[model samples]
Target: MTQPAFVAPGVVTAFCPKPTSHTGVVVMVAAKGDGVVVLDSGMAEPMPDALGPALELLGATTADVRAVLSTHGHRDHTGGSRALRDASGALTYFSADDEGLAGFAPDVPVTDGDVISSGDLRFEVVTTPGHTAGSVCFYEPTLKLLVAGDGVQGVGSARKLPVYYESGTRYRASLRKLLALEIDTLVVGHPLAWRGANTHVFTGAQCHELLEDSFAAAEAIRAAVAAVGPHPTPHRAALAVLATSPIFDHFDPGDPVEEDTEATLDSELRDLAGTAVR
Candidate 1:
């Protein structure tokens, strides 16, 4: 576990459990008055107490956690929610669209613009459906901080390609939506890289730059899939798409991009067949 880094007047963050692992979560804590909120709990089993460091830094305990917010339903992000909630008796907020994917029912189903308040910290939910149908980002406009989880993946450190199991178009759109926000500090679930730099945190202009690169990387994959036609297997298609993009030049080819390639191609093929039938 890494030490909790002070993000703002009331916010602090730490990459819980294995900081370098893509499967680990970035735990963020915000407090004001007597209430504290935790965002993105790590996996439950291996490191159920992943938020300990951040909580300690805040000089609080599980009892102070009034709400636990999940950026998405993925286990890495939500698996630890049960443990935390059990300890803190906190309300868990998740998106309704992702109820099917989550292991446990949420205390509250959040919408696109729901404002969650804890003392002076007010986090506005920004529903970004692409990484997953229910993926959401928390934006603290007053602090210009955005806890994005996996919502803005810019070619993550573990893989050469960005992965969005849902619609690539929607993923790109979500990135664009995030770009419109006034973000100075951006924290993500993984140590995603752009060009040659890898980090889970982005500040000031780096936030915009990271979002742009992520958007462009997704577009490059979309275009590459279209150009490669539909004859190749998903794996082969991924390789072809990779060969055409210089953004992946330094990284090793991995399975993550293949998943996205398959999803993107399948969507396009379905569209084409629909057009033909029409």
Candidate 2:
């Protein structure tokens, strides 16, 4: 039962109880009053059992929170959703595409452009399915704030690119969509590879700069895919690019470069499990 870290005036970032899970969601309080809303509930059994302690730390309660706005259906993101809803009497909403991964169905299956509001806080949902089929980001235009789910990833607070997930093409498009938005501060769901137990934050000019670099990486990945003739093994293509391109400023063939490209290589490579690539 750890309290979320204060990010700004009205926002706080919370974490899952487990060590493996870094970030769970962002909490937004009413601009002027007592209303509270959660971005995503961390993955916890019995729904949001840990949320009570977190809310306690924030000096709020399930009664104050009116809704749970989920960014995607990843277990880490949606695991505590059902419990949170039941406890807070909050309406839970997530993208339709992530039904399977989310395990439980949300009260509402929201799509792009949907609006979620609680008291004076308003968030516009932007669906960008790349990290997962139903991945999304929330934009508070008035605040110029972004609650970016797994759709974006990087090594530090300054993200130069979106982490590689399931689909390279879809991931590319999703990142581009996010970068196009006007944002003053960016809050992601989890810490980057280089950041441990620290909430990732990027603001002002740095937001645009890092996103631009990420976009460049996506563009380069697309070009590689095209050159490989459609269905090339993603790893091979990435390795080829790493060897020849400047996607990464430095790559040592002699050492394990896993940390440097954690976004692109970690889960994508490990998920291969025991499959043979003949």
Give me the candidate number with maximum TM-score: 1
Q: What is the C-alpha RMSD of each candidate to the true structure, in Å?
A: 2.7, 6.2
Q: Write the per-residue lDDT of candidate 1 for residues 1-278, one digit (tens) a residue.
A: 36777877777886666544543445555454357888888777754466777777888877788888989998778887888888878899989788777777789999999999877788999999888899999998888989998898886555545555477777889999999999989988876656666667789999998888888777766666666665646556655666658866645655455554566556545544565589
Weakest 10 consecutive residues, lDDT, candidate 2?
24-33
Model 1 misplaced stretches (Cα beyond 4 Å): 18-33, 46-48, 254-278
lDDT of 2 by residue, 125-172 (tens): 998876788898888887787888776764322222325466656776
Off by over 4 Å in 2: 1-3, 17-34, 46-49, 52-54, 155-162, 193-199, 223-237, 243-246, 249-278
Model 1 per-residue lDDT at 52? 71
Clashing pairs in 2: 160-214, 161-214
| Cα lDDT, model 2, residue 18 | 45
Best by lDDT: 1
Candidate 1 minimal-lDDT segment of 10 residues:
19-28
